[model samples]
Target: MNFWYVPWFILPYLLLAFILVKQHKKSNRSNLFFKFIYWSFFYLFIYLGITEIQDKSYFFTIPVLFFVLFSWMYHREKARVLNGFLLNLFIASFGIYLLYNFLITQDVLVFALIFLVGVFVVLVGLFGFVGLMILFYWNALVVIKRESHSLANLLTLILAVVMTIWLIYDSFIAKMLPDWASILLSILPMMFFYFVFAFLNFLSASLLYQFNQPSYDQDFIIVLGAGLVQGTKVSPLLANRIHKAIDFYYQQRKYTRHWVKFIMSGGQGPDEKTAEAIAMKDYALQQGIPEDDILIETNSTTTLENMQYSKEIIDRADIKAPKVIFSSNNYHIFRAGIFARMAQLKAEGIGAKTAFYYLPNAFLREFIAIIAMKRKLHFTIISLLASVLLLLSIIAHFVS
Candidate 1:
């Protein structure tokens, strides 16, 4: 409405929208700043609207809700591949918080809600984060007992041990240590905080990637492979992926009348009788998928290779601007998308269902992988934090 608001709130939001739409049109789905920029503008514009309220009509909610509406509309428009689901979670919680404060002003009934919440908090505090930690350790034990002893499966176990050790040290041992020694050891949790941030980002990105789907008219469904059963048959895990690809292939063909190819991608392991891709293709065929529609890339042993080798096959197909999607288990889809981008493949992933009990450990493993993917950035921030902490300690010594 005013000239000042136009520049401060309107212009920047419109500019962000334009950049996102432009990047979206070009299929540049890798910009990690989109969510941050969008949400920043979202809260800013809302706060601005609240400040400038002049008994405006309901339509004034347009500017107040502009960024929220924009997020809802554009989120499914292939722009959500950038991740940050935690931002969405934050939006909901913030909205509820604001709504609660507003309604508390209206009636005494709201006080009952607050009182109930306080009571619930008190009850739950009896078995709070410590209880949560106990569950985490138990889950880790279950993962180790039921799954392989591989490093991936051992993630929960390792994390549990680290957390328990830190809890004991921070709770009991820190009091007896020398002041400087205690101060330095305090950096352990500070360092852990950085990794915790990375884990949250990874978790958010994984949820966002899985929720944002590809169009039904994709040209190919590249099924990323896993290991086989006893070196011959498609393991249930691998079969879940193939089943997902087939389901998508069938649904797309049925609804859109667009026949998509399946690129079964994987290689034989040291103990396998044949390539994982071959076994995947065999399973797909048994499910009544046409053999002509299934293509196999049998040389990929890792997810990275799956993307790279599959891209090579896709390039050889000689189609101009072909649309493609890959199929894998839900937890694996996010990382597979990263690998696809790394391989320069313009594709989205269609995630298959993962079991409930399996998700926590699988997500932890994926979180670790994502953290490893950006070791340099983490190391730099960590080093900077260490220097800051040491400087603060030195200053505190002199000040004291």
Candidate 2:
């Protein structure tokens, strides 16, 4: 057994220990990303060591170690969606590694059996596209029946149909196209998968944050407003947010000696009879909250404006070192938190429950919004990946 691979395994541990110490000293999202990267490298090194030593039995420990670390990180910060996503990716990579190892080491009979199973899985996946189209159409029709026929409401259904079509074309029709056209078509699926990965990350993070209980030490509770019904009354979505903020206020009062101020943030829209802030305030007062305890921010329409204007109100109140909590519907909390961060407000979020039927469309909209928020970065990554794929295709064409 060559001991040279031992140091390769040990190096990642040392690096991770340093990162862990840094994270403990000053925790932030970037630190979490670094920790994930380091942990992945740690596992990769372990796999390398196992392969070098020819100890196939040790392969089983990789996944066990992955689960242990994933659970520990998830327990530490349940609200971090990116962390969950990284852990999921790690497990997937490990599974692939195991499959590769099995193919290399197993007997011919076992290989043939595995190959047959693999082919079966592929065939099922191909046929599964039809099932996916059915599901998508059903969801689309249900959404159209229950909601308005607006493009926003139909986004998920539209995307599902488009993806299904693209997959079919890429699988069967791309090979018949010109080389450049085929390369471009092939790149679409990769980009789609990347988008799907990102969407899942944001959705998981949002859902995790929604389910976790808010801490009771907040100094302020901000309720973000949605559009009103008929431009006057509070919509069900907006009402849920106010109720969530009130619940948090009462929960905090049980533990804290200070009063938690409620900031109702929303401006009047062109279609509204009154400012969203005014409507939310009136609703909160009717719900039995004192007028003195509620502060109205009546000049903001968007979530970012909600954060910015609300922060001004918090500042005007002369509250020092305010720990704030914002409330929105569950699907909206992740993006709301991002907005709060953009406004330089140190705030956590609590999500009220949303209707189950509405969640998929809502989540899809939020995912698109998040992508738009970092459009430059996303464009750069997709362009680079596509370019590489195109280059590889061109090289293969020339070689052949």
Candidate 3:
């Protein structure tokens, strides 16, 4: 037998192990997509390496590796428990198939294994589609629930729930039928779901455009800062934010929400001459925001700190509970909420319009932020669960 396959199995794992060790020691972890890709490659290499070393069959190792990974995921404390469960199902189902093929004389076991695998695959697909729907609709519900009065809220919530249930029912029924029919039915629904989700984001932004400007009772409107170009001139990204703030200021004046103080929150970059807050103030005045109502908060750099520090300035004049709005790009609304909640501020997160090309990039950044904040509990649970499941499967393999 050619031994050339040995190094091929060993090299990727060696690199993967290196990266994993490096990442574990770092204060910040890498993106989930990268982590998954690296780990997948690592696991694949390990399975192949083990097969080569033990002179065992590839089929057994492949299924066994999947079982271990899935079991680890299942028992682990990650939010992806459903994923782990499905993977475990695949491994367990595959294991049973192998066992029946080797130990039983009947073809019925093979048929049963096939049936199990089919069901498992269908369920996994359903879970993925539904999970996406849940995430999207939940975000949509949050917007609707917040903006809508009680009557509207009730109707919207019911509609959302009904739509979700309908999707699940439709998927289950279609999958229960013949294979070709199932595939055909699944395609349109899944595409429609994604289409709706994509358009809902736009709809959400449109709703944001209707934010009432400050009239007579308005006190202050705050514009959150994005990173500047070279820490000096406002990046086009940040310009969008400033532009919205200017619009809000003018709109409020138009609607009789007059003399709203504009507070810009951001610290100066090391390379920039002035703080972001100061720069924003200058930019707004350049665009005709009166210098008197414009206050600059230049001390803090973070979103939370931006809010906190700005509130200090706002409170100096005995205006603590101002009907404040913090503006950021649309993708950042949820995270800005988290920071606002943390700072104990009474503020509504208003999203400014962002460029379409920039949104995908912005969303990726937000997703990474969410993962980093809750990684330990997530990773630890996932690892432990996967390990336990793998152990149980191993014991079961030996005993059976």
Candidate 4:
């Protein structure tokens, strides 16, 4: 048999391999996710090209390329959980496409009924209907456990309920509503899709930062402050961060001869009698860290300020290109890294453990903050998607 397609198929892979090698060597975290996307598409196109030459019928195997790419990415970076979810979504879409085409080819009536049922089932599963229910119940428990009903605490549950409704309406009632209403509803799904992918990218990037271990030769460790207990003592959340920093400091000392300064960063809230930095610093002193090794940044009211003020202290001390590590709860590590990048500080992150019940809410809060920070890009993309959906709806309405 002739092998005319072999070089064409192999050439792209060779090019992708070269690019991946260069990216790996450059190793910039900012562009790493996009690099992964490029790599995924490279493999996908190769599979499609090979299948096309072999036989058109073999095209059903195209979805397998996505799974293969996901497996490779996961093996390389397990923290890219969102990337796994995204690849799985593509695989699911391919399966749905095959099923729809097969049913339509076999019988139109059967296709309509089966397609409706299948879409409902898949949408329900993808939208996490059952997971949302469980989250709602869990949020209730968390509210009671924490004895606070802050809106932030309820955001995840509220989102789950809203999404469930949106999915149901889009699946079952979109065509039944008035044209304007249908168009608006149609736009919502487009926006939802955009937001889900964007949020996943942010979360994946954040988790990637958390998974990156810092070098042991760091010159500074910045412990970002959470709220204190009655403003006088470190809360469990804050204590965990400080403890992680102390552990890092000791580890650096044990392995390297350089002295690492601990920067306790936080500001005083109105309810607190003392600044968060002072409380963290005191806690560190009690943990037996030397007084000379602890630096206090008492003016930072936010994560960005923590990095900024800590960098100032580092600069003031005349430390040249100080390798730094910032510590926070695991859920907050990614956002801290983002702040560090914004502050133009070269620092890695270390995450302390958090309570199981608190993680979902905390993660949601972080996701919202990330979105806010990139609101311009997100808003523009979302607006464009909504416009496209609305335009398509108008054309379909007129055609019908």
Candidate 5:
């Protein structure tokens, strides 16, 4: 056996990759399926090449290299903010990580084949499962005690306690239970896998969203609103958003002759002394942003409304094809971009820095919110999967 004429097929693969990338750039979100197809073929090509090359490193390096390549492409293409490209990137990265662990630990190969639960254990590493669980519990408690009593923030505490109970039951108590009882309880693991898959993807996408840096050619810096401190003052959290916009404003002017206008988007809450947008404007004014340059939209009660109302203002401002950026806290940007897309606003979001400890808790809430957006579709899939598992369990139960 010898190597020859590999170029005949290899050239077409390269050509297909080019066409897919070009189509994705042209159609953006609507072209997401092309990305999925591209990655599927990409992995297949890698596996097939390994047979010819007889090199195991191709399995590891090729996936990681493609992940980096697409990740760089994702960061550069600000046009498609909420598309499947990011999800594909995460899939490539996760698969590469699992493969790396298998190649290294050898004995770990079996576990890595079983999906994230096994990889989760792999991550536990020298710390061990018990040690990792204890660390999770400690962080959960810290979040619950320090954060507000909102249900969103309390999810960490609830998850920590629930996982602890489930593990205890599965590890020890399940051995003594009747076969059918245990069979029925297997549904929990099924659901656990489903949710863990979702949560991990969300975490990956949220983490990747931060790498987006919009160009200085923007015409509008739309600052999304947050809750006011004591209903009357701009909190540090809100100021961070304003400052991100202001920094971009100055940077745009410094780099080019173009000037950008700020759109302060927020409405009055019941406890607020004034509209949040007005309060944000006051803060920007104090920071030396000209009152004339800032446009206030004080009617948005939610993030979607913020995008919709701001789009209206931009449309009426008589700007042709206005390039815009929306600024919010880092965790909030991904979800807000979803809203921006829904509102048919052609703009990319730019997130500002927020506190570290607050990120995980905030991210949990954002993940839930994004899930809720496609609730009917997601609920149907979850129900279908759960039903399949439950049906299997029932068959075992009846046979027993």
Candidate 6:
């Protein structure tokens, strides 16, 4: 059936346009791009729901409601988290579509769409997480190459935009041209874009890992607690960091005759009877670390507070001024450093290994935290640049 036959689509678009006009007249919000995406999705959902109502096709509405549900539930002030929720919702919608297709008719078109969606979803999801590693490597590359990160980021943005547009165009051409070759058209472009960024990130991370191996020993080593499991026992995630610190302690013992103290730093969470720091200390003792060498800092719940309050405890103990090593997980090291640097603690940021599949959820969480910081200026800059680039690209396309 032709999509134009659905009057619901037409009505929703008209209503969406009116809403945009009203918002534009009433508010100082100049985010036309964001408004466009928001209204587009809003209307598309209404269109789908209305069509499903008229046709009595209840299955199609399930995915639409699911998307709305998850998006609202995960809604935060962070762009990355917002992006992630939307991305995941799209994947969920596509999966639902596949189920609908299988139930209705087992056709090649639906099968192809499913495969194409899978490719794009994998591409986008993998790169979104790996982008952090890219940023890290990009930092090192810029330092050595004496290049500006802003320029590099701009170029990357341009390339991603171009590749996505090309992929869309190529998919249309592939669908139009032939029967057997259409799937190849959809899959190849997405896979290519995904692998291109994936390999770049992998190489960059390798370089970062190689360069970032210069380790140091300090009088005080702070294991920043990853909040407790059920706010009681040390989480396996937090335990990994503690174990790393223990290994470092044993290594120090083997190399030098100096005594080092471990500081388990975190505060009481709402659900916990005791502070996270105390739990970490107990875990350390259970793991065979001597009790005397373990210091518990129970006043910090955040990373910044972890460093700040831990520093005070060390200062009061008259243990040398602020040279410390901090252990968290691998993906967390960069942001942890930002906090450590903010606290002006002389610190080494070390990360324990984490499982691959769980990285997306964790990284999405971190991205949300980062975006909540000084966000207005960052959003303004991003919006301005996106607008300019979009206008330029459109103008170039029209002229050509």
TM-score list, all predictions: 0.76, 0.72, 0.47, 0.69, 0.75, 0.49
Q: Give the per-residue lDDT digits (tens) of candidate 3, residues 194-265.
A: 434433443333332223222234576778886677767887778888887677666666656456787889
Q: How far is candidate 1 from the true structure (C-alpha RMSD, Å)?
A: 8.8
Where is model 1 more than 4 Å wrong at Cα? 1-82, 85-127, 398-400
RMSD of each: 8.8, 9.1, 21.7, 9.4, 8.3, 21.8
Error of 6 at 380 (Å): 2.9
When summed lDDT is taken over every stretch of 10 residues in candidate 6, the lowest stretch is: 205-214
Give lDDT: candidate 2, residue 324: 88
Cα displacement (Å) at residue 370, model 4: 0.5
Per-residue lDDT of candidate 1, residues 187-284 (tens digit): 88999877777677667667756666666789989999887889999887878888888877777777689888999999999999999888888888
Query: What does candidate 6's lDDT look like per residue over 1-400, in tens digits?
Result: 2344545456768777877877665332324544666677676555444444555666666676676665554233111223344545565675886657545544444455678877997888888734644554453444335323443234443444555566567656655754334433434454444435433433333223212321334688889976677768888788899987887787667656457899999899888878999999999999999999999898998999998988787779875454677788876765676687678676766677776544543453454456566477656755665555556555655655
Q: Tell me how candidate 1 scores on lDDT.
A: 0.73
Q: Candidate 5 residues 224-243, lDDT tens each?
A: 99899989899899999999
The clash numbers for all candidates, in the given order, read 0, 1, 17, 0, 0, 0
Stronger candidate by TM-score (1 vs 6): 1
TM-score of 5: 0.75
**Per-residue lDDT of 38-142 in model 2, one digit per residue for the tens?**
576566545554563474445545655775676677656554556558667665755565576555544343244457767987888987867766776778888
How accurate locally is residue 278 in candidate 1, as Cα lDDT from 0 to 100?
Answer: 88
* TM accuracy, model 1: 0.76
Better candidate number, 1 or 3, judged by TM-score: 1
The true-versus-predicted C-alpha distance at residue 30 of model 6, in Å, is 48
What is candidate 3's CA lDDT for residue 242?
82
Regarding TM-score, does 4 or 5 come out ahead? Answer: 5
**Residue-level error in angstroms, candidate 2, position 356:** 1.0
Worst 10 residues of 1 by lDDT: 102-111
Q: What ranges in model 5 sit over 4 Å off?
A: 1-124, 127-132
After superposition, the stretches of candidate 2 with alpha carbons farther than 4 Å from their true spots are 1-81, 93-130, 178-181, 254-258, 396-400
Alpha carbon lDDT at 44, candidate 4: 46
